[model samples]
Target: MKTFFSLLQKKLFAENAPLVMLVGLCPLLIASKTLISGLVMAAAISSVLIFSCVVISLVRKLIPDNVRLVAYMIIIATLVSVAEIMIRAYLPTHYVNLGIYIPIIASAGIVFAQADNVASKNGIVVSVIDGTLTAITFSIVIITVSFLRELLGSGTILSHRMIEEEYGMSFALSGGGGLVILGMLAAVVKKINSIKKSKKEGE
Candidate 1:
Protein backbone atom coordinates (compact mmCIF):
# COMPACT_ATOMS: atom_id res chain seq x y z
CA MET A 1 0.00 0.00 0.00
CA LYS A 2 2.73 2.42 0.88
CA THR A 3 4.61 1.39 -2.24
CA PHE A 4 1.51 2.06 -4.32
CA PHE A 5 1.18 5.55 -2.89
CA SER A 6 4.85 6.23 -3.51
CA LEU A 7 4.63 5.16 -7.13
CA LEU A 8 1.46 7.19 -7.55
CA GLN A 9 3.12 10.33 -6.24
CA LYS A 10 6.11 9.74 -8.48
CA LYS A 11 4.00 9.27 -11.59
CA LEU A 12 1.44 12.01 -10.91
CA PHE A 13 3.29 15.02 -9.50
CA ALA A 14 6.95 14.25 -8.91
CA GLU A 15 7.61 12.73 -12.33
CA ASN A 16 4.53 13.99 -14.22
CA ALA A 17 3.17 12.61 -17.49
CA PRO A 18 3.74 15.14 -20.22
CA LEU A 19 6.31 17.24 -18.37
CA VAL A 20 8.58 14.57 -16.94
CA MET A 21 8.15 11.59 -19.21
CA LEU A 22 7.18 13.61 -22.30
CA VAL A 23 4.41 11.31 -23.37
CA GLY A 24 1.22 11.93 -25.34
CA LEU A 25 2.12 15.12 -27.16
CA CYS A 26 -0.53 14.84 -29.88
CA PRO A 27 -3.57 16.06 -27.92
CA LEU A 28 -1.30 18.04 -25.66
CA LEU A 29 -0.46 20.46 -28.47
CA ILE A 30 -3.46 20.35 -30.80
CA ALA A 31 -6.43 20.06 -28.44
CA SER A 32 -5.11 22.30 -25.70
CA LYS A 33 -6.24 25.66 -27.04
CA THR A 34 -8.90 25.79 -24.37
CA LEU A 35 -9.22 24.38 -20.87
CA ILE A 36 -12.36 22.47 -21.81
CA SER A 37 -10.59 20.89 -24.74
CA GLY A 38 -7.57 20.00 -22.63
CA LEU A 39 -9.67 18.52 -19.84
CA VAL A 40 -11.66 16.45 -22.28
CA MET A 41 -8.51 15.20 -23.90
CA ALA A 42 -7.11 14.34 -20.48
CA ALA A 43 -10.17 12.30 -19.58
CA ALA A 44 -9.90 10.34 -22.80
CA ILE A 45 -6.21 9.64 -22.35
CA SER A 46 -6.62 8.73 -18.69
CA SER A 47 -9.38 6.27 -19.51
CA VAL A 48 -7.24 4.64 -22.13
CA LEU A 49 -4.27 4.54 -19.80
CA ILE A 50 -6.11 2.97 -16.90
CA PHE A 51 -7.98 0.46 -19.02
CA SER A 52 -4.94 -0.52 -21.03
CA CYS A 53 -2.83 -0.90 -17.94
CA VAL A 54 -5.38 -3.17 -16.32
CA VAL A 55 -5.72 -5.30 -19.42
CA ILE A 56 -2.00 -5.54 -20.03
CA SER A 57 -1.20 -6.30 -16.44
CA LEU A 58 -3.76 -9.10 -16.26
CA VAL A 59 -2.47 -10.74 -19.45
CA ARG A 60 1.19 -10.11 -18.92
CA LYS A 61 1.94 -13.70 -18.08
CA LEU A 62 0.46 -14.98 -21.30
CA ILE A 63 2.30 -12.49 -23.49
CA PRO A 64 5.58 -13.65 -24.95
CA ASP A 65 8.46 -11.38 -24.02
CA ASN A 66 9.76 -10.84 -27.55
CA VAL A 67 6.35 -9.99 -28.99
CA ARG A 68 5.24 -7.80 -26.10
CA LEU A 69 5.45 -4.65 -28.19
CA VAL A 70 2.94 -5.98 -30.68
CA ALA A 71 0.72 -7.16 -27.87
CA TYR A 72 0.82 -3.78 -26.18
CA MET A 73 0.05 -1.87 -29.40
CA ILE A 74 -2.90 -4.08 -30.19
CA ILE A 75 -4.32 -3.50 -26.73
CA ILE A 76 -3.77 0.27 -26.85
CA ALA A 77 -5.24 0.62 -30.33
CA THR A 78 -8.35 -1.29 -29.30
CA LEU A 79 -8.84 0.91 -26.26
CA VAL A 80 -8.30 4.07 -28.26
CA SER A 81 -10.91 2.92 -30.76
CA VAL A 82 -13.36 2.44 -27.95
CA ALA A 83 -12.62 5.90 -26.63
CA GLU A 84 -13.03 7.42 -30.09
CA ILE A 85 -16.40 5.83 -30.64
CA MET A 86 -17.68 6.82 -27.21
CA ILE A 87 -16.49 10.39 -27.60
CA ARG A 88 -18.06 10.77 -31.03
CA ALA A 89 -21.35 9.50 -29.70
CA TYR A 90 -21.40 11.40 -26.41
CA LEU A 91 -19.58 14.64 -27.24
CA PRO A 92 -19.84 15.33 -30.91
CA THR A 93 -18.54 18.85 -30.62
CA HIS A 94 -15.44 17.83 -28.69
CA TYR A 95 -14.95 14.84 -30.93
CA VAL A 96 -14.97 16.99 -34.02
CA ASN A 97 -12.79 19.61 -32.37
CA LEU A 98 -10.30 16.89 -31.55
CA GLY A 99 -10.86 15.17 -34.91
CA ILE A 100 -8.21 12.63 -35.91
CA TYR A 101 -6.04 13.50 -32.98
CA ILE A 102 -8.04 11.34 -30.57
CA PRO A 103 -7.44 8.18 -32.52
CA ILE A 104 -3.77 8.95 -32.89
CA ILE A 105 -3.51 9.12 -29.14
CA ALA A 106 -2.98 5.38 -29.21
CA SER A 107 0.10 6.08 -31.22
CA ALA A 108 1.34 8.39 -28.54
CA GLY A 109 4.77 7.13 -27.42
CA ILE A 110 3.84 7.36 -23.76
CA VAL A 111 1.27 4.56 -23.74
CA PHE A 112 3.49 2.01 -25.40
CA ALA A 113 6.47 3.24 -23.47
CA GLN A 114 4.77 2.69 -20.14
CA ALA A 115 3.46 -0.70 -21.24
CA ASP A 116 6.91 -1.78 -22.30
CA ASN A 117 9.01 -0.24 -19.56
CA VAL A 118 6.88 -0.47 -16.41
CA ALA A 119 3.89 -2.76 -16.92
CA SER A 120 5.94 -5.54 -18.42
CA LYS A 121 8.25 -5.61 -15.47
CA ASN A 122 5.83 -4.97 -12.63
CA GLY A 123 2.79 -6.74 -11.18
CA ILE A 124 -0.80 -5.78 -11.94
CA VAL A 125 -1.32 -3.58 -8.91
CA VAL A 126 1.84 -1.54 -9.44
CA SER A 127 1.17 -1.23 -13.14
CA VAL A 128 -2.33 0.11 -12.55
CA ILE A 129 -1.12 2.71 -10.10
CA ASP A 130 1.69 3.78 -12.40
CA GLY A 131 -0.62 4.09 -15.36
CA THR A 132 -3.17 6.13 -13.43
CA LEU A 133 -0.53 8.42 -11.99
CA THR A 134 1.03 8.95 -15.38
CA ALA A 135 -2.32 9.74 -16.92
CA ILE A 136 -3.29 12.15 -14.15
CA THR A 137 0.04 13.92 -14.33
CA PHE A 138 -0.35 14.28 -18.07
CA SER A 139 -3.84 15.72 -17.62
CA ILE A 140 -2.67 18.29 -15.11
CA VAL A 141 0.14 19.65 -17.29
CA ILE A 142 -1.89 19.83 -20.48
CA ILE A 143 -4.81 21.40 -18.61
CA THR A 144 -2.55 23.99 -17.04
CA VAL A 145 -1.08 24.89 -20.40
CA SER A 146 -4.48 25.03 -22.05
CA PHE A 147 -5.87 27.23 -19.31
CA LEU A 148 -3.06 29.68 -19.77
CA ARG A 149 -3.44 29.71 -23.53
CA GLU A 150 -7.19 30.26 -23.40
CA LEU A 151 -6.93 33.09 -20.93
CA LEU A 152 -4.11 34.91 -22.69
CA GLY A 153 -5.07 34.12 -26.27
CA SER A 154 -8.80 34.83 -26.04
CA GLY A 155 -8.98 36.65 -22.72
CA THR A 156 -11.48 34.04 -21.62
CA ILE A 157 -11.54 31.39 -18.93
CA LEU A 158 -13.36 28.31 -20.19
CA SER A 159 -15.29 30.72 -22.42
CA HIS A 160 -16.41 32.78 -19.43
CA ARG A 161 -14.62 35.87 -20.78
CA MET A 162 -12.49 37.14 -17.93
CA ILE A 163 -10.19 39.82 -19.35
CA GLU A 164 -11.41 43.22 -20.40
CA GLU A 165 -11.81 43.63 -24.14
CA GLU A 166 -8.96 46.11 -24.32
CA TYR A 167 -6.51 43.68 -22.73
CA GLY A 168 -7.54 40.83 -24.96
CA MET A 169 -4.87 39.63 -27.33
CA SER A 170 -5.20 37.38 -30.35
CA PHE A 171 -2.10 35.20 -30.09
CA ALA A 172 -3.41 32.77 -27.49
CA LEU A 173 -5.05 30.27 -29.81
CA SER A 174 -2.59 30.82 -32.58
CA GLY A 175 0.47 28.66 -33.27
CA GLY A 176 2.32 30.87 -30.81
CA GLY A 177 0.37 29.33 -27.98
CA GLY A 178 1.55 25.89 -29.03
CA LEU A 179 5.13 27.06 -28.90
CA VAL A 180 4.56 28.55 -25.48
CA ILE A 181 3.18 25.26 -24.26
CA LEU A 182 6.25 23.49 -25.56
CA GLY A 183 8.44 25.97 -23.76
CA MET A 184 6.52 25.39 -20.57
CA LEU A 185 6.96 21.67 -21.03
CA ALA A 186 10.69 22.15 -21.33
CA ALA A 187 10.73 24.22 -18.19
CA VAL A 188 8.87 21.54 -16.32
CA VAL A 189 11.34 18.88 -17.44
CA LYS A 190 14.19 21.08 -16.25
CA LYS A 191 12.57 21.54 -12.87
CA ILE A 192 12.08 17.82 -12.46
CA ASN A 193 15.68 17.11 -13.35
CA SER A 194 16.79 19.74 -10.87
CA ILE A 195 14.77 18.14 -8.12
CA LYS A 196 16.15 14.73 -8.98
CA LYS A 197 19.65 16.14 -8.80
CA SER A 198 19.00 17.69 -5.40
CA LYS A 199 17.62 14.42 -4.11
CA LYS A 200 20.68 12.59 -5.35
CA GLU A 201 22.90 15.09 -3.58
CA GLY A 202 21.01 14.61 -0.34
CA GLU A 203 21.35 10.85 -0.64
Candidate 2:
Protein backbone atom coordinates (compact mmCIF):
# COMPACT_ATOMS: atom_id res chain seq x y z
CA MET A 1 0.00 0.00 0.00
CA LYS A 2 2.79 2.43 0.89
CA THR A 3 4.64 1.69 -2.33
CA PHE A 4 1.42 2.05 -4.31
CA PHE A 5 0.72 5.49 -2.90
CA SER A 6 4.31 6.56 -3.46
CA LEU A 7 4.20 5.54 -7.11
CA LEU A 8 0.81 7.20 -7.50
CA GLN A 9 2.20 10.46 -6.15
CA LYS A 10 5.12 10.30 -8.60
CA LYS A 11 2.82 9.60 -11.52
CA LEU A 12 0.44 12.42 -10.65
CA PHE A 13 2.95 15.22 -10.00
CA ALA A 14 6.53 14.24 -10.82
CA GLU A 15 5.73 12.86 -14.27
CA ASN A 16 3.21 15.21 -15.82
CA ALA A 17 1.91 13.78 -19.10
CA PRO A 18 2.13 16.92 -21.22
CA LEU A 19 4.90 18.87 -19.57
CA VAL A 20 7.22 16.08 -18.51
CA MET A 21 6.27 12.98 -20.48
CA LEU A 22 5.58 15.19 -23.54
CA VAL A 23 2.92 12.95 -25.02
CA GLY A 24 -0.45 14.11 -26.40
CA LEU A 25 0.88 17.29 -27.92
CA CYS A 26 -1.29 17.46 -31.02
CA PRO A 27 -4.55 18.00 -29.17
CA LEU A 28 -2.85 19.98 -26.44
CA LEU A 29 -1.43 22.47 -28.93
CA ILE A 30 -4.30 22.69 -31.39
CA ALA A 31 -7.62 21.86 -29.71
CA SER A 32 -6.60 23.69 -26.57
CA LYS A 33 -7.26 27.07 -28.20
CA THR A 34 -10.03 27.66 -25.72
CA LEU A 35 -10.80 26.61 -22.17
CA ILE A 36 -13.91 24.62 -23.13
CA SER A 37 -12.15 22.91 -26.00
CA GLY A 38 -9.32 21.89 -23.69
CA LEU A 39 -11.73 20.58 -21.07
CA VAL A 40 -13.60 18.55 -23.66
CA MET A 41 -10.37 17.09 -25.00
CA ALA A 42 -9.28 16.22 -21.49
CA ALA A 43 -12.60 14.52 -20.74
CA ALA A 44 -12.56 12.67 -24.02
CA ILE A 45 -9.02 11.36 -23.55
CA SER A 46 -9.58 10.58 -19.88
CA SER A 47 -12.59 8.39 -20.66
CA VAL A 48 -10.77 6.47 -23.38
CA LEU A 49 -7.62 6.03 -21.30
CA ILE A 50 -9.41 4.83 -18.18
CA PHE A 51 -11.86 2.42 -19.80
CA SER A 52 -9.33 0.99 -22.22
CA CYS A 53 -6.88 0.44 -19.40
CA VAL A 54 -9.52 -1.41 -17.40
CA VAL A 55 -10.52 -3.57 -20.34
CA ILE A 56 -6.98 -4.29 -21.42
CA SER A 57 -5.79 -5.08 -17.94
CA LEU A 58 -8.69 -7.44 -17.35
CA VAL A 59 -8.00 -9.32 -20.57
CA ARG A 60 -4.24 -9.14 -20.54
CA LYS A 61 -3.73 -12.82 -19.89
CA LEU A 62 -5.96 -13.79 -22.78
CA ILE A 63 -4.33 -11.58 -25.40
CA PRO A 64 -1.43 -12.72 -27.52
CA ASP A 65 1.74 -10.67 -27.49
CA ASN A 66 1.84 -10.38 -31.25
CA VAL A 67 -1.75 -9.14 -31.56
CA ARG A 68 -1.91 -6.92 -28.48
CA LEU A 69 -1.15 -3.75 -30.39
CA VAL A 70 -3.99 -4.37 -32.79
CA ALA A 71 -6.28 -5.19 -29.88
CA TYR A 72 -5.39 -2.02 -28.02
CA MET A 73 -5.96 0.12 -31.11
CA ILE A 74 -9.35 -1.44 -31.73
CA ILE A 75 -10.42 -0.90 -28.15
CA ILE A 76 -9.21 2.70 -28.06
CA ALA A 77 -10.81 3.54 -31.40
CA THR A 78 -14.11 2.09 -30.27
CA LEU A 79 -14.06 4.09 -27.06
CA VAL A 80 -13.19 7.27 -28.95
CA SER A 81 -16.08 6.71 -31.33
CA VAL A 82 -18.47 6.34 -28.43
CA ALA A 83 -17.12 9.50 -26.84
CA GLU A 84 -17.56 11.46 -30.08
CA ILE A 85 -21.18 10.40 -30.48
CA MET A 86 -22.11 11.22 -26.91
CA ILE A 87 -20.36 14.58 -26.98
CA ARG A 88 -22.00 15.50 -30.27
CA ALA A 89 -25.39 14.52 -28.88
CA TYR A 90 -25.07 16.21 -25.49
CA LEU A 91 -22.44 18.94 -25.85
CA PRO A 92 -22.82 19.98 -29.44
CA THR A 93 -20.74 23.11 -29.07
CA HIS A 94 -17.82 21.36 -27.46
CA TYR A 95 -18.14 18.51 -29.90
CA VAL A 96 -17.83 20.89 -32.82
CA ASN A 97 -15.07 22.84 -31.15
CA LEU A 98 -13.05 19.69 -30.50
CA GLY A 99 -13.61 18.72 -34.13
CA ILE A 100 -11.29 16.02 -35.48
CA TYR A 101 -9.16 16.02 -32.37
CA ILE A 102 -11.70 13.88 -30.56
CA PRO A 103 -11.34 11.16 -33.14
CA ILE A 104 -7.59 11.61 -33.24
CA ILE A 105 -7.37 10.75 -29.59
CA ALA A 106 -7.45 7.12 -30.66
CA SER A 107 -4.03 7.53 -32.24
CA ALA A 108 -2.69 9.91 -29.61
CA GLY A 109 -0.17 7.19 -28.55
CA ILE A 110 -0.42 8.25 -24.93
CA VAL A 111 -3.48 6.07 -24.34
CA PHE A 112 -2.23 3.06 -26.26
CA ALA A 113 1.24 3.38 -24.75
CA GLN A 114 0.01 3.31 -21.19
CA ALA A 115 -2.55 0.61 -21.84
CA ASP A 116 0.01 -1.52 -23.60
CA ASN A 117 2.93 -1.07 -21.26
CA VAL A 118 1.41 -0.69 -17.80
CA ALA A 119 -2.05 -2.16 -18.17
CA SER A 120 -0.84 -5.24 -20.00
CA LYS A 121 1.57 -6.03 -17.19
CA ASN A 122 -0.31 -4.86 -14.10
CA GLY A 123 -3.41 -5.88 -12.18
CA ILE A 124 -6.75 -4.19 -12.75
CA VAL A 125 -6.51 -2.00 -9.67
CA VAL A 126 -3.03 -0.79 -10.50
CA SER A 127 -4.04 -0.11 -14.09
CA VAL A 128 -7.06 1.87 -13.00
CA ILE A 129 -5.06 3.97 -10.59
CA ASP A 130 -2.39 4.61 -13.22
CA GLY A 131 -4.96 5.54 -15.84
CA THR A 132 -6.85 7.86 -13.49
CA LEU A 133 -3.72 9.65 -12.31
CA THR A 134 -2.32 9.99 -15.82
CA ALA A 135 -5.58 11.43 -17.04
CA ILE A 136 -5.66 13.84 -14.13
CA THR A 137 -2.11 15.03 -14.75
CA PHE A 138 -2.80 15.45 -18.45
CA SER A 139 -5.97 17.36 -17.68
CA ILE A 140 -4.20 19.70 -15.29
CA VAL A 141 -1.53 20.74 -17.82
CA ILE A 142 -3.85 21.04 -20.81
CA ILE A 143 -6.49 22.94 -18.84
CA THR A 144 -3.93 25.35 -17.44
CA VAL A 145 -2.47 26.04 -20.89
CA SER A 146 -5.96 26.57 -22.30
CA PHE A 147 -6.93 28.90 -19.50
CA LEU A 148 -3.81 30.96 -19.98
CA ARG A 149 -4.17 31.02 -23.78
CA GLU A 150 -7.83 32.06 -23.73
CA LEU A 151 -7.15 34.70 -21.13
CA LEU A 152 -4.18 36.16 -22.98
CA GLY A 153 -5.40 35.71 -26.54
CA SER A 154 -8.96 36.89 -26.14
CA GLY A 155 -8.74 38.64 -22.79
CA THR A 156 -11.56 36.48 -21.49
CA ILE A 157 -12.09 33.75 -18.99
CA LEU A 158 -14.30 31.05 -20.42
CA SER A 159 -15.46 33.49 -23.11
CA HIS A 160 -16.48 36.12 -20.61
CA ARG A 161 -14.69 39.36 -21.32
CA MET A 162 -12.20 40.02 -18.56
CA ILE A 163 -10.15 42.43 -20.65
CA GLU A 164 -10.74 44.31 -23.84
CA GLU A 165 -9.79 42.31 -26.95
CA GLU A 166 -7.67 45.22 -28.11
CA TYR A 167 -5.50 44.76 -25.05
CA GLY A 168 -5.31 40.99 -25.25
CA MET A 169 -2.33 39.39 -26.93
CA SER A 170 -3.85 37.95 -30.06
CA PHE A 171 -0.65 36.04 -30.74
CA ALA A 172 -1.50 33.74 -27.88
CA LEU A 173 -4.18 32.20 -30.07
CA SER A 174 -1.69 30.97 -32.65
CA GLY A 175 0.35 27.75 -32.68
CA GLY A 176 3.54 29.65 -32.11
CA GLY A 177 1.94 31.17 -29.06
CA GLY A 178 1.01 27.76 -27.76
CA LEU A 179 4.59 26.63 -28.18
CA VAL A 180 5.80 29.61 -26.21
CA ILE A 181 3.44 28.81 -23.37
CA LEU A 182 4.42 25.14 -23.50
CA GLY A 183 8.08 26.02 -23.33
CA MET A 184 7.56 28.24 -20.30
CA LEU A 185 5.55 25.55 -18.60
CA ALA A 186 8.23 22.96 -19.35
CA ALA A 187 10.80 25.25 -17.79
CA VAL A 188 8.69 25.65 -14.68
CA VAL A 189 8.25 21.90 -14.35
CA LYS A 190 11.99 21.38 -14.79
CA LYS A 191 12.74 23.92 -12.11
CA ILE A 192 10.35 22.27 -9.70
CA ASN A 193 11.94 18.90 -10.35
CA SER A 194 15.36 20.34 -9.68
CA ILE A 195 14.15 21.80 -6.40
CA LYS A 196 12.70 18.46 -5.39
CA LYS A 197 15.95 16.73 -6.31
CA SER A 198 17.93 19.14 -4.19
CA LYS A 199 15.62 18.59 -1.23
CA LYS A 200 15.91 14.83 -1.57
CA GLU A 201 19.67 15.04 -1.75
CA GLY A 202 19.80 17.23 1.32
CA GLU A 203 17.62 14.84 3.29
Candidate 3:
Protein backbone atom coordinates (compact mmCIF):
# COMPACT_ATOMS: atom_id res chain seq x y z
CA MET A 1 0.00 0.00 0.00
CA LYS A 2 2.78 2.42 0.83
CA THR A 3 4.55 1.60 -2.41
CA PHE A 4 1.33 2.11 -4.34
CA PHE A 5 0.80 5.55 -2.82
CA SER A 6 4.41 6.48 -3.53
CA LEU A 7 4.01 5.49 -7.17
CA LEU A 8 0.83 7.53 -7.40
CA GLN A 9 2.58 10.57 -5.97
CA LYS A 10 5.43 10.21 -8.45
CA LYS A 11 3.02 10.02 -11.39
CA LEU A 12 1.15 13.09 -10.19
CA PHE A 13 4.21 15.28 -9.64
CA ALA A 14 7.69 13.85 -10.02
CA GLU A 15 7.08 12.03 -13.29
CA ASN A 16 4.17 14.01 -14.67
CA ALA A 17 3.23 12.74 -18.12
CA PRO A 18 3.35 16.07 -19.94
CA LEU A 19 5.79 18.08 -17.86
CA VAL A 20 8.36 15.42 -17.14
CA MET A 21 7.89 12.51 -19.56
CA LEU A 22 6.75 14.93 -22.30
CA VAL A 23 4.26 12.49 -23.74
CA GLY A 24 1.11 13.68 -25.54
CA LEU A 25 2.67 16.96 -26.65
CA CYS A 26 1.39 16.95 -30.23
CA PRO A 27 -2.25 17.46 -29.32
CA LEU A 28 -1.16 19.58 -26.39
CA LEU A 29 0.64 22.15 -28.52
CA ILE A 30 -2.09 22.32 -31.18
CA ALA A 31 -5.31 22.08 -29.17
CA SER A 32 -3.89 24.33 -26.48
CA LYS A 33 -4.38 27.44 -28.60
CA THR A 34 -7.41 28.20 -26.50
CA LEU A 35 -8.35 27.34 -22.92
CA ILE A 36 -11.57 25.59 -23.89
CA SER A 37 -9.89 23.60 -26.66
CA GLY A 38 -7.19 22.44 -24.24
CA LEU A 39 -9.76 21.36 -21.67
CA VAL A 40 -11.71 19.45 -24.30
CA MET A 41 -8.64 17.60 -25.49
CA ALA A 42 -7.55 16.85 -21.94
CA ALA A 43 -10.96 15.50 -21.00
CA ALA A 44 -11.16 13.38 -24.14
CA ILE A 45 -7.71 11.89 -23.61
CA SER A 46 -8.34 11.27 -19.92
CA SER A 47 -11.56 9.37 -20.55
CA VAL A 48 -10.00 7.24 -23.24
CA LEU A 49 -6.86 6.53 -21.22
CA ILE A 50 -8.67 5.56 -18.05
CA PHE A 51 -11.14 3.23 -19.73
CA SER A 52 -8.53 1.68 -21.97
CA CYS A 53 -6.17 1.00 -19.08
CA VAL A 54 -8.92 -0.63 -17.06
CA VAL A 55 -9.91 -2.87 -19.96
CA ILE A 56 -6.35 -3.73 -20.85
CA SER A 57 -5.44 -4.60 -17.29
CA LEU A 58 -8.44 -6.86 -16.98
CA VAL A 59 -7.46 -8.80 -20.09
CA ARG A 60 -3.66 -8.61 -19.75
CA LYS A 61 -3.14 -12.28 -19.05
CA LEU A 62 -5.29 -13.53 -21.90
CA ILE A 63 -3.30 -11.57 -24.49
CA PRO A 64 -0.31 -13.25 -26.10
CA ASP A 65 3.08 -11.67 -25.53
CA ASN A 66 3.98 -11.50 -29.20
CA VAL A 67 0.73 -9.83 -30.31
CA ARG A 68 0.36 -7.57 -27.27
CA LEU A 69 1.38 -4.41 -29.13
CA VAL A 70 -1.17 -4.99 -31.85
CA ALA A 71 -3.79 -5.87 -29.27
CA TYR A 72 -3.10 -2.70 -27.30
CA MET A 73 -3.49 -0.57 -30.42
CA ILE A 74 -6.84 -2.19 -31.23
CA ILE A 75 -8.12 -1.65 -27.73
CA ILE A 76 -6.99 1.96 -27.68
CA ALA A 77 -8.50 2.62 -31.10
CA THR A 78 -11.87 1.25 -30.04
CA LEU A 79 -11.95 3.47 -26.97
CA VAL A 80 -10.85 6.48 -28.97
CA SER A 81 -13.70 5.87 -31.37
CA VAL A 82 -16.21 5.85 -28.57
CA ALA A 83 -14.78 9.10 -27.14
CA GLU A 84 -14.74 10.77 -30.57
CA ILE A 85 -18.35 9.90 -31.23
CA MET A 86 -19.50 11.19 -27.87
CA ILE A 87 -17.54 14.39 -28.30
CA ARG A 88 -18.94 14.96 -31.77
CA ALA A 89 -22.47 14.37 -30.56
CA TYR A 90 -22.31 16.62 -27.51
CA LEU A 91 -19.55 19.14 -28.23
CA PRO A 92 -19.61 19.68 -31.96
CA THR A 93 -17.68 22.93 -31.84
CA HIS A 94 -14.92 21.53 -29.67
CA TYR A 95 -14.92 18.37 -31.75
CA VAL A 96 -14.23 20.41 -34.84
CA ASN A 97 -11.63 22.53 -33.10
CA LEU A 98 -9.76 19.47 -31.90
CA GLY A 99 -9.90 18.04 -35.44
CA ILE A 100 -7.39 15.25 -36.20
CA TYR A 101 -5.84 15.49 -32.76
CA ILE A 102 -8.89 13.74 -31.32
CA PRO A 103 -8.35 10.70 -33.44
CA ILE A 104 -4.61 10.86 -32.88
CA ILE A 105 -5.19 9.90 -29.28
CA ALA A 106 -5.62 6.37 -30.54
CA SER A 107 -1.87 6.29 -31.23
CA ALA A 108 -0.69 8.51 -28.42
CA GLY A 109 2.53 7.25 -26.84
CA ILE A 110 1.42 8.22 -23.35
CA VAL A 111 -1.55 5.86 -23.44
CA PHE A 112 0.40 3.03 -24.99
CA ALA A 113 3.36 3.46 -22.67
CA GLN A 114 1.13 3.31 -19.61
CA ALA A 115 -0.60 0.24 -20.92
CA ASP A 116 2.68 -1.49 -21.69
CA ASN A 117 4.57 -0.50 -18.57
CA VAL A 118 2.08 -0.28 -15.72
CA ALA A 119 -1.36 -1.54 -16.69
CA SER A 120 -0.31 -4.81 -18.28
CA LYS A 121 1.63 -5.93 -15.23
CA ASN A 122 -0.52 -4.48 -12.47
CA GLY A 123 -3.83 -5.28 -10.80
CA ILE A 124 -7.01 -3.65 -12.06
CA VAL A 125 -7.13 -1.16 -9.19
CA VAL A 126 -3.50 -0.14 -9.61
CA SER A 127 -3.92 0.27 -13.34
CA VAL A 128 -6.98 2.45 -12.82
CA ILE A 129 -5.19 4.59 -10.26
CA ASP A 130 -2.13 4.96 -12.49
CA GLY A 131 -4.31 5.91 -15.45
CA THR A 132 -6.30 8.44 -13.45
CA LEU A 133 -3.24 10.10 -11.90
CA THR A 134 -1.35 10.25 -15.18
CA ALA A 135 -4.38 11.75 -16.89
CA ILE A 136 -4.75 14.33 -14.17
CA THR A 137 -1.09 15.27 -14.50
CA PHE A 138 -1.40 15.63 -18.26
CA SER A 139 -4.57 17.69 -17.89
CA ILE A 140 -2.99 20.01 -15.35
CA VAL A 141 0.03 20.78 -17.50
CA ILE A 142 -2.01 21.30 -20.70
CA ILE A 143 -4.59 23.47 -18.94
CA THR A 144 -1.86 25.61 -17.38
CA VAL A 145 -0.17 26.06 -20.74
CA SER A 146 -3.47 26.88 -22.40
CA PHE A 147 -4.36 29.42 -19.73
CA LEU A 148 -1.05 31.19 -20.09
CA ARG A 149 -1.08 31.11 -23.88
CA GLU A 150 -4.63 32.38 -24.12
CA LEU A 151 -4.02 35.12 -21.58
CA LEU A 152 -0.75 36.32 -23.09
CA GLY A 153 -1.63 35.85 -26.75
CA SER A 154 -5.30 36.81 -26.81
CA GLY A 155 -5.46 38.95 -23.69
CA THR A 156 -8.44 36.94 -22.54
CA ILE A 157 -9.32 34.16 -20.18
CA LEU A 158 -11.76 31.72 -21.70
CA SER A 159 -12.47 34.33 -24.40
CA HIS A 160 -13.78 36.93 -22.00
CA ARG A 161 -11.40 39.69 -23.14
CA MET A 162 -9.80 40.79 -19.92
CA ILE A 163 -7.53 43.45 -21.31
CA GLU A 164 -8.97 46.62 -22.85
CA GLU A 165 -6.60 46.51 -25.81
CA GLU A 166 -4.77 43.66 -27.48
CA TYR A 167 -1.71 44.15 -25.32
CA GLY A 168 -0.71 40.48 -25.34
CA MET A 169 2.10 39.34 -27.58
CA SER A 170 0.85 37.86 -30.86
CA PHE A 171 3.69 35.34 -31.01
CA ALA A 172 2.61 33.76 -27.76
CA LEU A 173 -0.48 32.33 -29.46
CA SER A 174 1.43 30.59 -32.22
CA GLY A 175 2.52 26.93 -32.21
CA GLY A 176 6.21 27.85 -32.10
CA GLY A 177 5.49 30.13 -29.18
CA GLY A 178 3.75 27.28 -27.40
CA LEU A 179 6.86 25.15 -27.69
CA VAL A 180 9.05 27.86 -26.26
CA ILE A 181 6.74 28.35 -23.33
CA LEU A 182 6.54 24.64 -22.68
CA GLY A 183 10.29 24.32 -22.71
CA MET A 184 10.72 27.20 -20.31
CA LEU A 185 8.09 25.74 -17.99
CA ALA A 186 9.79 22.37 -18.10
CA ALA A 187 13.11 23.94 -17.23
CA VAL A 188 11.57 25.75 -14.30
CA VAL A 189 10.07 22.54 -13.01
CA LYS A 190 13.39 20.78 -13.36
CA LYS A 191 15.15 23.51 -11.47
CA ILE A 192 12.65 23.34 -8.64
CA ASN A 193 13.05 19.59 -8.41
CA SER A 194 16.79 19.93 -8.33
CA ILE A 195 16.57 22.42 -5.53
CA LYS A 196 14.36 20.11 -3.48
CA LYS A 197 16.72 17.22 -4.07
CA SER A 198 19.70 19.26 -2.96
CA LYS A 199 17.93 20.36 0.20
CA LYS A 200 17.05 16.78 1.07
CA GLU A 201 20.67 15.73 0.61
CA GLY A 202 21.81 18.51 2.93
CA GLU A 203 19.33 17.39 5.58
Backbone collision count in every prediction? 1, 0, 0
After superposing candidate 2, which stretches have Cα over 4 Å from the reference?
1-8
Residues forming the 10-long window of minimal summed lDDT in candidate 2: 4-13
Q: How accurate is candidate 2 locally (lDDT)?
A: 0.87
TM-score for each of the candidates: 0.87, 0.94, 0.93
1-203: candidate 1 lDDT, tens digit per residue = 89867776666656666666666776788888889989988899889988888898889999988998888999999999999999999999998888899998888987888888878888888888788878877887788888888888778888897988678667767767677667776786678768987998999
Worst ten in a row by lDDT for model 3? 5-14
Candidate numbers, best TM-score first, in rank order: 2, 3, 1
Better of 2 and 3 by lDDT: 3
Full-model lDDT for every candidate: 0.83, 0.87, 0.89
The candidates, ranked best first by lDDT, are 3, 2, 1
- Model 2 per-residue lDDT tens digits across residues 4-123: 778766875588777787788887898778898888888988999999989999989998999988988998999999999999999998877767878999889689878877899999
Which candidate, 1 or 3, would have the higher TM-score against the true structure?
A: 3
- Over 36-105, each residue of candidate 3 has an lDDT whose tens digit, in order, gives 9999989998998899889999999999999999999999999999999999999999888778888999
